[model samples]
Each structure stands twice: as C-alpha cells, then as structure tokens.
Target: MPLDRAKTLQDTMTQWRHQLHANPEIAFQEFDTAKFVADQLKSFGIEVQLGLATTGVVGVLSKGEGDCIALRADMDALEITEQNTFAHASKNPGKMHACGHDGHTAMLLGAAKILAESGTFRGTVVFIFQPAEEIEGGAEVMVREGLFEKFPIQEIYGLHNWPSMPAGQMAVGPGAMMAACDTFDIVVKGRGGHAAMPHLVVDPILASAHIVTAVQSLVSRWVSPHDSCVVSITKIQGGDTYNVIPDEVVLKGTARWFSPELGCEIEQALRKIIEGVGKSMGCDIQLIYDARYPPTINTPIEAQVSADVMASLVGETNVNRNPIPSMGAEDFAFMLGKRPGCYGWLGAGQSEDCPKLHNPHYDFNDDLLSLGAAYWVALSEHRLI
Candidate 1:
C-alpha cells in the first residue's frame, strides 16, 4: 500500500525536486523559490501567505478548528558551486542545494498534495516555507514578526537530510538534537616591520597565532571531556606582502556546543584568551563574539510523538529514539526556543562515497522523497488527531 501511494507521486515529486535543484538561491534572496513554492501550494488548494521575513511562505490548510501543527522546510541554498554534471545540475553558478533543502521542500509539498486530495487529516496543518536559513536566521525573524501570533500554531516540526545515516531511517532525541552556533572575530593591532628585523616591531601575526592555539583550549580544558562541542578556526587574514609584518591580523572562526550555557562559556573564554594574549604581547586585541543559533532542543513529548509516528510508518527497528546529537547548528533552534517542536534527521546514506553536507558534490537523496513525504503526512495527521 505504501509503495503504490509513493509510486503515484514519485514522478511528480522528482520533477519538482529537479527544478528546484537546477535553480538554487541563497538566503534572504529566495524570491523565485518562494514564488515557485506558493504556486505549487496554491495549485493544491492550499492558501499561502507571503512576505514574512522578506521571502517566507505560509500555506494554510484547515478542516475544522482543533490544533495546528507547522511543518517547515527551508528554501534557501548555499553559496557553493555545483560540481555534479548531471542533467538536473544547478543552473545558477556559485549556488547549489548542498544541504538537501530542495528535497525537504519537495517532500512537504508532496504531503500537502496528498492531504489536499485525500482529505484524510483533521484540524489544520501549516506548511512553513522559510528563507535565509543558511545565514540570515529566517526563523528568528519570523518569530520576531509574530509568526505564532498570526498562525497560532501549537507545535512546529522540521527535518534535515543526514548523509551520514542510511536512507529509510529516522534519528531523534528529546534533548539537544543539534548544537548552538556562535561566531568570533579577533583583531590584533601591532607595529609593522620588515621580516629581516628581529626586535623592531610587535608582530600582530604572531600574536594571532598564539591566540588561535589558546582558544582551542576552551573545548579541551575549559569544557568537560564528556561534553560535545567544537572550536574551529576557519579563516585568517593578516599580511599580503612577502617580508613585511602587517599592522593588524584578523582571526575568525565558529564555536559550536550542545549545551545552552556552553555558548556563553565559550564566548567568555574566547575573550579571555585574546585579552590575555594582548596583555602579554603589549598590543591591542579586540574580540567580537556573536551568538547565532541556539541549541535545537526537542521537547520531550513532541520528540516521543515523532519517534512513535516514524516507527509506525516504517517499523520499530528502523527508528532511532536516542541517536547521538550533532554539533552542527540549525536555525530551527530559534523556532524551537519559542515553541515546542522536534527537529529531526532523515538518513540519506552512509556510504563513504556519499557526498556530505556543504560538499560541492552533495545532492539530496531522491529515493527518500516518498518516505519523507509519508512521514510528514503521518506526523501532521497524528498531531492533529
């Protein structure tokens, strides 16, 4: 029965997925993508509201007043250039859906179509198509602009395609499903001099080097060994010339932690490290730490619901209720902060050759589209009933 139902929508969903994959857009600039989604929803007889958080779309489908559950799918792509040479490859250069958000959107849309046609569910199901999830915090902006106030949704739900896990399985937990994302930028000012000189200048570059090494201790020493966290130095900019020491060196990186308190702890420790280096080097150092996404914590009850529903869809053996949490951050954390929800993972593949998230060759697994859409339908119906 599931196979036949999925087979009916497989072709249409694949076409929609390919279309979205071919024309990838980035955060806050998903005008075309939002339009396409709205049009699709409208064709399915769903009412859509546009202009929330610049390019967000809300599709409302209601039978009778009871409770509302929102299913969200981010429509923004990354700034990566597509490496796959397939026929459905990205048409826009320097932009691709490396995170499988295209698949996510298509899956939700498939559920909307099935529900609209069959009219099987009760109450209301809000389809949230958000923009700028990659960088602009579209969920945060929507909440600030009264998304809940307008929609009055009781519970929200979201999902991401996890390439590390095999397809046809779901992994979730009650606590932190994903970590908080915080970014830091440090600038050190020092005297400039030629490399040939030994003691003529305070080398900002040297101080930055030490600061980088010191900040790593925040995770290894400041945080507990049992805790899950990451402190990575991703970018550094200082000198352009070959032999001349620059006047200032800039260091930038991201800090990730599953514990909410760990975000502030890392920020404080980062400042201390840079300040201590500045004092020791007798130079000026500035630290800027910005709290981005909060920890994506699933409310216990909702998480249990997700686990139960997915188990019914597949089987108890295929569902993981206590999978390890990811250090990666999600903007859905912002939504979960305001309301109760479960942000889950849908396994894409586990093979070593499978492309991972943010990789240039990464692509959404199309085989999971039917299963994902089924899960969305079952989840919304279960919650509403």
Candidate 2:
C-alpha cells in the first residue's frame, strides 16, 4: 500500500521541495514559508494553527481515538549564499536551505497528505513546522509558548538529512545522538606599555596565549580519556599597533560535549584555568559562558520502535541502529526533553558533489523525497497500529 502511495507522493513532494528551495527564508523570518505550509495543511482538511513562535505552524489530524504523536520539521534557512546552479536555486539573497530543511518539510507534508487521505491510523498526528532553528531556539520557544500543553503530545519525532550516509539507508540510536553546544568569551585585563619595555606594564596578549594552550589540555589531560569533549578557540582579538602591548585581549570559542557531567566539568575547568592564569600574570579575567541546547538523548523503547519501523519499511539491512553520534547540536533536543522520542537521520546521499550543511554549495536531495515520505508514513502507521 505504501509502495503505490510513495510513487504518487514522491512527485508531489518533489514539486513542493523545489518551491521551498527557490524561495528560502531565514530564521524567525519564515513568513511566506509558514503561509505555504499552513495553506497546504488547510487544503488537505487538516486543522492548522500558527503564531506559536512568530512564524511557527502546527497541523492536527485526528483519526479514530488514541494517543497523540507529533512530527516536527524545521522551516528556517541558513545565512549562506546559494551556489546550486539548478533552476530551483534559492532566490533569496544570502539565504539558502543548505541544511536540507526543504526536504524535511516536504517529507512531513507528504506524510500529512497520506495520513489525511488514507485515514488508516487509529490516533491523532500533530505536524509541527517551526522556524528560527538556525539561530534562536524555535523548538525551545514553542515549548515556552505552551505548545505541548495546548496540543498534548505523547511522543515527538524529528528527522535530519545525512549527507555522508548512502541513499535509502537510515540511522538511529538510543542515547546521546547529538552534543550540547556552549559558547564562551573571556577578556583579560592588563596595562598597556612599550613592547620593548616588558617590566614597565603587564601584557595580556601573552597571558591570553598561555590561557589558550592551557585550556586545550583540560580535555586531553583533565577530563577522562573515554569521554568526548571539544574546546576550540576560534577567535582572538587584541591590540592594534605592533610596537605597543595591548591593554586587554579577548578570547571567544565554543565547547561541545556528549555527556552532561563532562560538559559541566569542562565549564568549571575553563573558569579555574582562566582565573588562575589571570591572577598569576597580574591581570583580571572576566568570563561569560552561554549554554545552548542539551544533548539529544533518545529513549530506549522509542529508539527501538523507530529502528523497527524503518527496518520494516526499508528492509532490516538498510537500517543502522548504532550509528555514530554527532557533536553538532540540535534544537529538537528541547522537544525530546519534554516527551519520550527518537530522532533519526535520513540519507541524502551525494548529489552533484554538493558540500555539507551550512556550506554555500549544499542543497537538499530532492530525489529522496519518496523514501523520506515513505519512512514517515511507515513510522506513523507502525506507531499507531
């Protein structure tokens, strides 16, 4: 039954994906994109609700009587300039759907259409189309705005397109599917003086250099060798003239960790290292750390359900249960925090040798529309049955 429906739905989804790719919108600014999604849901006789997080859209479909399951798709584009030479290339300047969100949105919409038409499920399905996933936490905002309270969902599921995996292959895991992203900034205060006269004033540039090298050792030496952590100093700013020592130096970077305890330990170590170095060098240090989304942890039972559903749809051999976890962060972690759920990766494959997400050359693989839509349908049917 899904095979026949997949064929027809594939064509429709391709068109929808192309339209979205051509007219990409950035985070929190998905006005037209939200309108298109809402209109499509309304046309299919699904109840549509908007204005959850500015441009967020939610569609509800109730069949017989049972639990409510929610499916989510992010609707925001990156700030990258489109480099795809295809006819459906992004028309919005400096904004492109390099993350394959166009495909994600289209696939969920396809599932909605199938559910609306077949009505084979015995429960309700809530389709969430969110915005600002690239910058501000769209899922976080939805939760803050009473998304789950207003529409009571039992389990939530999210899917992201994976470029490295082969087409038609799916990856799912039980815990720590993605990392927690935290950003930090440190400013070292010192007195400016002539470069040739070292004894005249305290130099923060040298102190910052020492701090950078010392911070790198925290993960390698201080933290457990088995644990995974990344501390990278991406930016450093200081003085202007070469002959004069700067009064202060600023350091900016990000930290990623899969374990919550390790994440906390890293932050604590950073503070100690920064302040210790500052005090030793006769300088004052100010540090600010902002925590983003938490690690994406999949419930054990839900992970098994997701993997089983994919295996049933596309053979057991095509479904991978122990795929490697990614260090990148996902806002979907917020939704998973509220309800037991699982997130899986949909293979996008290599198309025109496009670059990865956030790259200017990256574009969603439209050819995988049928497979993605079929996966969504199979997951819904399997869960509800």
Candidate 3:
C-alpha cells in the first residue's frame, strides 16, 4: 500500500534524481542543491530552513501535537569524474554523485510531498538534507550550529543506498553499524642522493616503504583476530626523478575501528611502529593523525522502530535485523552520537559488474526511488504516531 502510494511520485522523483546527479556538488558547496531542495519543500507547503551546516536544508511539517522526529538524507556528491556516458551523467567536472546521495535526496523530497499532502501523521516531521557527508562532518557542524536547539526533535533517522545488497532488502540493527575513521599523515625525512649510490646516502623512500609495511602488521599481528581494525597507506609521494633519491617521503592513510578503546590502542600501536621504523632507518618521522567520524551506533528502541517500519514496507524476510557492520564511515555518526537514532541501508540492486560507491562508473539505482520514499513516509507516520 505504501509502495503503491509512493509509486505515484516515482516519475517526478526520478527526474529530480537525474537533475541532481548531472549537476553534482561537493561538501559545503551545495548551493544549487540546497536551493533545489528548499524549492521542493516550499512547493510541498513545508517550512524550510537553510544555512544550518552551510547548505544544509531542513523541512518541517506539522499536522497535530505529538512527538517530533527527524528523517535525514545527505545531499553532497564525491569529487570523482563521471565515466558513464548516460544522458544524466555528471556535468560538473571532477565531481559526481557516485555515492547515491542524489537518490537519497529525491526520496526524502518525495516523502515530504506525500506527508505534506496527506496530513495522515500527527506532530512534526523534520526533513534534514545534510551536506558534506563524504569526508567532512556536516552533521557535527549542524549540531554545533544548534540544529536540535532550533527544532524540537526527539529522535532522528537516516538511510543510505547499498549497492552490494539486492534491491527490496533493508538492514537495521542496534550497536555499531559503521566504523570510526581517522586519517594519518607521516612525513619521512632523510638525506638526498643518487639512486645508484644507496649506501652513500640515507634513503627516505626505503624508510617510508618500511614504515608502510610495518604499520600493516599493527592490524594483523597486534590486534586480536576477533577485533576489526584497518590501517591502510593509500598515498606515497617521494622522488621526482627516478635516478635520484628524494630527501623526503610522505605517507597518507586511514584507520578504522568500531570501539573507542580499540581506536586508542590502534593509534598508540601505529605511532610506536612508525617511530620505531623511522628510528631504525635513521629518518626523522613526523606523524599527524586526525580523528574524523565516530562509529555509527544505533539505539535499540529506534533500531527496532526502523526495522518494524522497514518490515511493513517490504516484509519480515526482506529486512535484515542483524547484518554485519561496514568499515565505511558516515558523518551521520555525528548525529547519532548526539541523539538516539538509527541509520539504515537501502539495497540498490545492480549487476555484479556494476561499480560500487565512489567509483567513476557508479550511479544511483533509480528504481529504488519509490521504495525509499515509501520507507521514509512509513517511518514518519510510524514514529510520529
């Protein structure tokens, strides 16, 4: 029934999703995206608020006096060039909607229209369109800017499209749903010399390589097999000429873990390894580690509420109540940290060869528009009741 109701708006939602995908924006620079969202909310007769987290949009709809809840969707795109030749492929150079935020935005907008017109739910529903969910913590910025203080919201909810899972299936549960992400930069300094003369000069590249290989042991050998932790050295920059050894080498990577204690231990162990490697190789190492998004943990009550709403839309069998958590980080973790809420994953069925999120060839599955919108509507109606 909810799916049927949501189907009526599928055509329009698909168009909106395509438009957003074509004109992708990144992080706090979602001016056009915010305006489009605000205009849609205005058309739905919902009160709109802007500039919360520098382009974040919030739509409020009140029918009666009861509990106020928030349903959120991220609106920012990634900085990846589109490789698809589709009609709606990204027009913005070096930016693309590879993370399916376009569909997330359109679905929530579609839900706002339905909830605004039907008048079936009591109390208020806050439709939050967040920005900068990829790397920057826009949810944290909104909270610091008094998002909850400005609006009388009790609990919040968020959803993300998962291409790895098949369509018509959903995942929600209590406890950690996503890991915390922390970035580290290590600079190795050594003497410069010709590549042919290895013993004649101290080589930073050799030291940096050892540092990289040594840190991997932190996750594999230091941490227990039962615990999940990741230390990856993604970028390595050093020499300009192949014939000469560079004076300095830079290493950048990220660390992910679910528990705070494990996170601390990871940092300590990583620092020790890098420092030890640098000392052994006679190189000066400078390490810079920044704690980014926290682990996204769902509260039990709201998790059950989300699961029940999802089951109502699809079925008990379609809803995965105990799915394994992901290593991928979400800024929604910031919001869940502040309020009791649950963040869920919506399956976007694609072929096995299809690219996943952040890939240049990846695109949001448009078929999921109706189901996602219906889920949001059902969630609002259920939670507000």
Which candidate should be chosen as best, given lDDT against the real structure? 3
Our tally of clashes for model 1 stands at: 0
Off by over 4 Å in 2: 351-354
The residue pairs that clash in candidate 3, if any, are none
lDDT of 3 by residue, 1-385 (tens): 6788899999999999999999999999999999999999999899999999899999999998899999999999998989999999999999999999999999999999999988478899999999999898999999999998999989999999999899889999999999999999999999999899888778899999899889879988999899888889999998998799999999999999998889888778988998899889999999999999999999999999999999998899999998899999998998888889999999886777678888899989989999999999998888777
- Between prediction 2 and prediction 3, the one with superior lDDT is 3
Off by over 4 Å in 1: 1-4
Model 1 vs. true fold: TM? 0.97
**Candidate 2 C-alpha lDDT tens digits along 195-287:** 999899899999999999999888888889898888989999999987999999999999989888888788889999988998899999999
Residue 253 displacement in candidate 2 (angstroms): 1.0
What TM-score, computed on C-alpha atoms, does each candidate reach?
0.97, 0.97, 0.97
Clashing pairs in 1: none
Model 1's alpha-carbon lDDT is 0.89
What local lDDT score does residue 175 receive in model 1, on the 0 to 100 scale?
A: 94
